[model samples]
Target: MLNEMRALTVSELTHQIKQQLEGTFFHCVVEGEISNIAFPASGHVYFSLKDSGASLRVVAWRTQAGKFRELLRQGEKVEIRGSITLYAPRGEYQLVANQVSPQGVGALYAAFEKLKNQLRLEGLFEPFHKKTIPAHPRKIGIITSQSAAALQDVLKTLRLHRPDIETVLYPSLVQGADAPASIVNALNIANTRAEVDVILLVRGGGSIEDLWAFNDEAVARAIFASTIPIISGIGHETDTTIADYVADLRAETPTMAAKLSAVSQDELRQALDLFEMRMTGVVREKVTKYRRYLHRLSLRLQAQQPAHFLKESRQTLGYLSEKLEHLMLKRLSCYQQQLTNYEARLNPRHLVGQQAMLLQQLSGLESRMADAVKRKQTQEEQRFEALVGRLNNLNPLAVLSRGYSAVKSGDQLISSVALVNQGDELTIVLSDGEVIARAETIIPHENSPHNKGI
Candidate 1:
């Protein structure tokens, strides 16, 4: 058989072997831990899958790599499904992965998926559990590595925003096996002291391994349990960790965390200056408006003054006095003319008869005049009594003396139960004193049996 295939070109022999391998392993699934991962600029992932003295070279193109990016990691166990292929240029045989997933997760990414579903069902990521950050925090606590450049960035941003805010640093390891515990301890310390208004857990950006501590369940639980609001600034804007989901706030960076926690002093100063200027302008406008109103009122009052009224009254009185004097003189002249006329008509010897007739007429006139005077006096007395009764009815002092109260709500009278509700504040006016009370209950007039007066 070897002689029958002799003298064949190297390419032909390799092709035959490639064809045999492809037919033998048309479609297969392999499980192993990832090692020697290399992502080249050619947009292909090259890695070796090894487990106990055996390794297979594998290649996943950019298309397949995208789907498995979240689930694949160095040293992580995985299962890959693909077909065997040969590269003619390099004359090498390799497995081309079509689909990749975490090992044994064909049953469903059971462990990862189970934890995600459980946490979601527990409402750990609900919006209602989110706490609002203080608009202006008096103090900020930082949980980070003391030697990290992240600390310096946070401090600088804070100083730029609000210099008066007190910063308390709780030093902790941000990486390595102890990082999760260190972070938890720092959070506990911050809570116990209660000196900080808000806590910020921050770290600089790094590779997935460098940021792995933030994904620890212990750290996530600690962040959730903290009573004080926490802002997490763990990595770059693109990075997300389990701690980021549980934290009250997520900031893009350490500088952003500081900026969010405090208000900018320059901005505040500018705002205050703007407010002061507005108030000054409003007050000045109001004063000018009121002054103009007062000036007009003063002019009107001057025109209506009592002195001007009194002077007009004096001129009217002088005119009435002159007319009264002229009328009196005319009446006296008419009386003298009447007397002369009567003397001409009377006889010199019949003076007694005329005197008797005059006395009778005089007596009749006196009787009529006396009756008119008595009627006038009776009407005047009745009018005076009616006036006195009306004055007594309108008197506020009289009502107060009778121990009656006049309650007022604002400037309005309080007369009905429908006007107020429970917990409404009221001003109660009694005859002797005033009391402020919040209404605890309102016994409706229709519902109260005592109000029936039985």
Candidate 2:
């Protein structure tokens, strides 16, 4: 009795009932007169399917009131085939029509559905089967009627944005009986040649009968099987066909198809700037390493004799300095050339401004580099001067200032009597002057005044 008395919330009961009714009428075919019809901007049709006995809510999604926009009318007798599903939010049951037709005219629509369902079951329309559309295609292959206005639209768009990219046209019938075969052949030829990076399957807007070729099984299969990614631009934004689903990408119009194939000039400029920044970063890293090496060498100088080490290190530092200067100049020149080349390719709109900015930046960089080199040179010079001052203090000339002298015979220093002969001419170097003298009599060490008792 307690089990029976247990209460269910309104939401829980509604959900249970929704599941039961939805499952019970999963697939249904209803023949009724249309009433309470509302066509919303989202392209989903809302209407009630009514007969004398009952009226059921029905929606034909994305049909846009069929190809000619006159398929459904108030009180018009029609058949809708779909699955029953709960709207959930309103807790109302409705029919989600996958196929809708006005009595006898359904034969063609039925065939479209048949092919769509079969291909869908085979997973051709799955995201996994779709190829990635190239972000920037170097060459785009166009497949359309030679006389098509859509072809002109595509060409004009590509020319406006990316005139550098080449295009190859494979003229094929876009309509009528021979179009399917022509399209298939074009696709096959494109695959065989593989000249283009991507293919644009395009046509002008038309009625369902006029656009029937794109729905052909052979065309759909060809599009799905192509090695090159295919972008379908068939009919207007509201129109949907089998090829649109099978394509790697779908554009609403022929112009949009071309626009999608290549990026804009602004994007290219940004890429160039990014490349320049990365290159600048590399140069900065090299400069930092060289500076650190110089710093390490400077620290090592204090512990070792500067005379010999400075001579050898000075050569190395000079070479490295010249090498660094040459490398920087070359890199800057390369950047200038690259900017000039890219500028030529880009649209002239605000191009002068960009070039000016880059030039300013380049000038700033050169100035900074010069400053860095100048500072480094000044630091090294200061360090060298201080080292020379220390060396001078240790020099014998400092001792000669306090009543001492150095005597030399020719280029040799006469340090002892054994180094000089009698009457040898000598040049004595004092602190501030030199004197010419002669060793008139060479005395033994024992006979010198310091060696004998005073």
- TM-score per candidate, chains pooled: 0.52, 0.46
Q: Model 1 segments beyond 4 Å from truth?
A: 1-116, 297-454
Count residue pairs with overlapping backbones in model 1: 0
Candidate 1, residue 106: the lDDT equals 61
lDDT of 1 by residue, 36-130 (tens): 98989988899999999889899998977765665557898988999999887788888899878668656543443455566668777677898
Candidate 2 runs further than 4 Å off: 1-105, 263-265, 298-454
Q: Give candidate 2's total backbone clashes.
A: 0
CA lDDT of 291 in candidate 1? Answer: 100
lDDT tens per residue, model 2, 44-115: 778899988998988776753464346567888887778898877787888887766665546778899999
**Which lDDT values do the candidates have, in the order given?**
0.85, 0.87
